[model samples]
Target chain A: MLLKVKNLNAGYGFLNVLWDVSLNIGKGEFVALIGPNGAGKSTVMKSISGLLPPKSGTITFDGQVINNQDCAVNCRSGLSYISEELNLFTGMTILENLEMGAQMLEDKNKARENLDFVFELFPRLEERISQYAGTLSGGERKMLAIARGLMSNPTMVLVDEPSLGLAPQVTDEVFNALRLLNRQGLTILLVEQNVTKTLKFSSRAYILEKGKVVLEGPSSELITNDHVRKIYLGT
Target chain B: MNNSRSIKAVEWLKSSGGITVTCTILVALAVSIHKGPYVLVNTLVTGGMWALMAIGVSLLFGVMNISNFAHGEYFMIGSLTAYYIMHPLKEYLLETPNSFLAFITPVLGIAGATLAGVIAGILTDKLIFAQLRKRNREGWLLNCFLITIGLSIILINLHMLIFGNTFKGVVNYWDVPSLALGDVYVSVDRVVVFFIAMLAILFFWYLMMYTTLGKKIRAVAQDENGARMVGIPVNRVYSTTFALACGFAALAGGSLLFMFPSYPTVGIAPLYNSWFIIILVGFGNVAGAVPGGFMIALFQVVTRTYMGEGWENVIPMFLISAILIFKPYGIFETKVRSVWEQ
Candidate 1:
């Protein structure tokens, strides 16, 4: 498995967000965690990505236990978390933001290669290369955030709520980009609120409700599951 | 051509009115008090140092979001170091008795002072700020303030115990004849100190505005987590930024020591003045610190020269309080939300 979480229990200041939340992602697999608002999906991503410390249980990525590591270490270990909230340095230009993401790479050549790949992946970024991230629209900022995450050339990308606040068409564009990235052999764990769409795209899905995983199966099977349909899809 | 000239004349007239009013007030006060130009010059030079110290404090707090109560200690360390290097601490330990070393002492003093300041900054970050950061403490600003205050007290008392409370003077490098330019008499020492201060500010401005390191510091200041996520070494940047702030404090301390006598308690006046200057300059804006410092210095000088010694205390207090009440960000307003937007 590229990433594994077993009985993870975590929270903020005594408020537990993830209780016994277990999930796994194999190498080069596109997995989605689809659930309602405040379902602890993002909390799971935070714990796995090392943004929030896990109170109990273990998170192993590529055979190495990474639960105690810092966010920077996790990122260096080839796991990038593109948070739902806009995380771009607003004062910096698009190029500077990309350069910041590639800071750990000592070689300029490798940074340039990543820069070129990100720019190619999102051409709109190239056009607004000199513009500050703050000036970019929500959709552009989201694209910039993803492009920044890709700059490190991580083994797995954990994206949280990429579709949030975006128009339906823009959401489709972002999902398509994720799918294209998955095809390029990068493992992706997507935490999303767009339940039906997320389920349709992923090979496997975990339905989270109130901090615990209620249902887990192949995406095709979960799509037709009665409980998931009633609670998530609003059938 | 005639119309354009008229427009230009109107714009110039409108802008010059504020300057004229200020100049008129200064003249009236100067005439009424009838103080010597020497005292006025002294106040101006001392005020400049205060402003410089304030700039450092504001930069650390406004940009880095670290309170750094230990900032005053850095200034004190710089002043004491400069004094010892220039004068040679014969009372403390064995003296080298090298005449050449004595001649180059001021430069060595400044260098030593800067080094001490840098060391203090690094130690604070490693021992306190870094630990707080790991625990996910958001009240680092308050903690930093407290830590720095404690450090200042400890350093001051230690200096008193080690160096004693006696005042010490640095050997003036430029003790040449004074220049008489019209009614204003400028001392070579003051001129050199003033020029050096200006150069240091210019150097800092250039570094912050143009360099890659400056860009990274500003990026981290904007959003530390965001910067970290992008692989920027946030802790490293924080330390470097703190070091830079201490370096500035050291420069100001060295310059102040050169102009005046130093005591263990000398840092108190500068620290007090810096508080006003920090508020006078828009928080986190280094460029504003220069003008803010100069303006406050100018005000202090003119007030002391024209009104009396009492106005020296009253003017800065009133001006700073008024400015804070009206524009808490200082004379220049920076986009505060931009710092948190990331």
Candidate 2:
């Protein structure tokens, strides 16, 4: 497996959000973690990405146990995380933002190749290279955020809700891009609220509630689960 | 980043800042034209340092949310550094006014002062603020305010104990004569200081706009999580931000060493003046501080000319009070949305 988590318990301050949540994903696989609001889905992503230290449990990535390592170290180790905040330098231009994403590259020359790849993924970024990130439309901002994550050229990308506040068409564009990326042999761990769409793209899915994982299986099987369709799917 | 569109607040410049600016310019022009160019030149000279100090304050409040009560201490450190360097060699520098040695001496002192400020900043941030950051910083704003106040007091007392409150400053780093503008003449030092401030602001702007380091700083300022997500070290950026702000303050102090002498209590006024600019420009409006500094300078110069010496301070206070009563947000208002956004 490219990534594995066992008995993960984490949260902010006294309120422990994730409780014994465990999941795993092999290389080149697309996996989804879907749950209701405050289901600790994002919390699990944060622990794995090293933004939040797990209260207890081990997060093994690429055969290495990265428990106390920070986000910067994880990023350098080829683990890219696109947070819900997007964190685009609002005062900076798109090009400058891209350069920041590629700042960890040991060789400056490779940054150009990464830039080309991200620009190809989101061409509107090229057209508006000089414009400030603050002015980008919502859909374009999501694309830029994802594109920025890709600029790191990570072994695995943990994306938290790329579709949030985005239209259906833009969400499809982002999902299709992720599917294409998974096919190209990059591991993806996505935390999204949209269940049906997530199950459609990802090979496997995990259902989380409150602070624990309730169900975990292949997306093909989970999509047909009665419990999922009744509550999450609102059918 | 949620882009929920809301009604933009009425900018102070379109109204109050506009009035203050237009009135200051009109009054300054008429007064200076009638009384000679002394007022205009003095405004320019004094305005330069004020602008630099204000920019530092703006960066602190906007980027780091550090209400630095000891900002002036950094300036004092710079001035002290410059005084130490220039005082002993004052004679040699005055003798060879245009020599390379003369030029480099002041530059070296200013550079040293900036280094001193950075060192002091690291001590305060890494040793103190970083620890506070590690804990529950829910009341961080109030905590930082008190901590900086305590820092200001400690530094002041420490300087008094060591340096004995004696005013120490150089006559001049160079022997260049004053420049005549119409009926009045202004010293070469003021012009140099003004240009230095402009250049520093320009350099800072370029660094922030183009460099990856700049992006990291801005990213940390906007959102720590965002910066972390992108692999930018947030804690390191915090320390760097504090250091940069202190360095800027120290540079201002060093450059204006001829005017502001080294004293234990020297930083207090500059700190207040910096806050004045921050208030006039809206707290954290980095770009607005430039003009706001000059506006404050003009008010001071004009008030001192017409009213007297101490009343210059009173005018700004009264004006700020009046402005606040009407447009409390200042010129370019920025609402604090999150812990990082402050």
Candidate 3:
């Protein structure tokens, strides 16, 4: 297994958001967690990314318990998290944003190689590398955020709401990029609102309602699963 | 053809930073032709030292969101530290004066002053600011200013009690020979002070631009939570930035002792001067503060030379009001942001 979470209970301040949530991802698998707005999907991603402390649970990655580790340390340990905020340093240029991801690396050559790899993945980013990130289109910003994550050369990536507030055409580009990365053997745990599109790309899917996992199965089965159909696909 | 050319010139002047630079150059040229090159050098040296203090203000406000109103007191303390150190050293050197010992005494005294400033900064952070940091209240900048205003008062009085009400003579540090060049004669001490200020400013610029620590400071300044997410210890950066600001202020104070007298309220005039510089350059714009300081210094020196010595006190206030009324972000607003945008 690349990543595992057991009975995760987490929240902000006194408000508990996640309860008894268990999930696991095998190496190189693409998994999706789908739900409506305010379904605690983002919170689960936050907890796994170590941005939020779990009230009760164990988050193990690569056989080490990484519950409540610092976000950067977790990132350095190969768990790249791209938050819903698309948290690129907006004031910085695109190249600087990518360089910041690999800032902790000692070998400049390694960082340069990673930068080249990211540029290969998102050539649009390379084309406009000198422009400030704030000026990028919504789709390009998402691509840049994912490319920044790749700069760290993470083993697994947890992405939240990649398609939020994007045009249908642009959303396809972002997801297609993720699919390409996944096919190259990077494990992915994605939290998204577009259940049908996410299911099409994911190997396995978990349907979350409110704070609980209502259903879980392979994506092929979940697409036809009656509960997922009624609650999500609107069929 | 001339009308179109003049319109283009007007457009260029109306653009960001163009008017400010043009105005500064005009003033500098007017001063040079009127007051001679010696006074120009003198004004630059004075401005350089003031710029160092302004840079401290900019850094503290930029990274920590705290405007260190008691910054001048740190400078005053540095001067006082130098005064206390030099008094004993002067007396000992007078008895069996060695040229090397005489040279080393002021150097050591300045070091002591810098150390004292850093220590005071650490204490201020641990005792007063750190508690407020934990509370993390809104209007914390206002809270910091209020507390620092009170701190400024307490520090002024404490200095009076400790060092006495009388102005302590700072003769040993600055009593160096003057160098004559053509019609202009410049003091070696002023030249040394200017070089030191430039070096210090360059060091800070290098630190913020190239180093990991500089990146961390900028990250914290941009977004504290974001910095923390990147594994930077935000609180530690805050404390270090504060200390560095204080150290810069102390260094300025130590350098000023060579030219000025040290008193309990010695920092009062410079405090107000720093406020003007902060306003002139905009708070948190460290790169602009140096040029802002020189502009103000030139304005003061020129006005004092032609108009009267009294205009030195009145001109900065007038300029501040004019700037606030028109360009409230200061002349170097765009430039400051661009310098760190990498």
Listed per model in order, the count of residue pairs whose N, CA or C atoms clash below 3 Å is 1, 0, 0
The most accurate candidate by TM-score is 2
Q: Model 2's lDDT to the true fold?
A: 0.84
Q: Which stretches of candidate 3 lie over 4 Å from their true place?
A: A1-22, A53-68, A167-169, B1-13, B36-38, B119-139, B172-175, B303-313, B333-342
lDDT of 1 by residue, B46-88 (tens): 6566656776787787567765566767788888887777665
Assess each prediction's global lDDT (C-alpha) against the native: 0.78, 0.84, 0.83
Interface RMSD of each: 1.5, 1.5, 2.4
lDDT of 3 by residue, B208-263 (tens): 87787787787777655455444456677777887888888888888878776678
TM-score of 3: 0.87
lDDT of 2 by residue, B1-342 (tens): 233322222343356666667787898899887767788877887787888888887787777787878899988888888788777666665565657777677778888888988888778889999999888668888888998999889888988998788999887766668887654677888888888888888888887766777778877776666677777878888888888888888888898888888899889888989998888778777778888888889899988888999898899999888777876778655454435443
**Of the candidates numbered 1 and 2, which has the greater lDDT value?**
2
The full ranking of all candidates by TM-score, starting with the best, is 2, 1, 3
Per prediction, fnat is 0.54, 0.65, 0.11
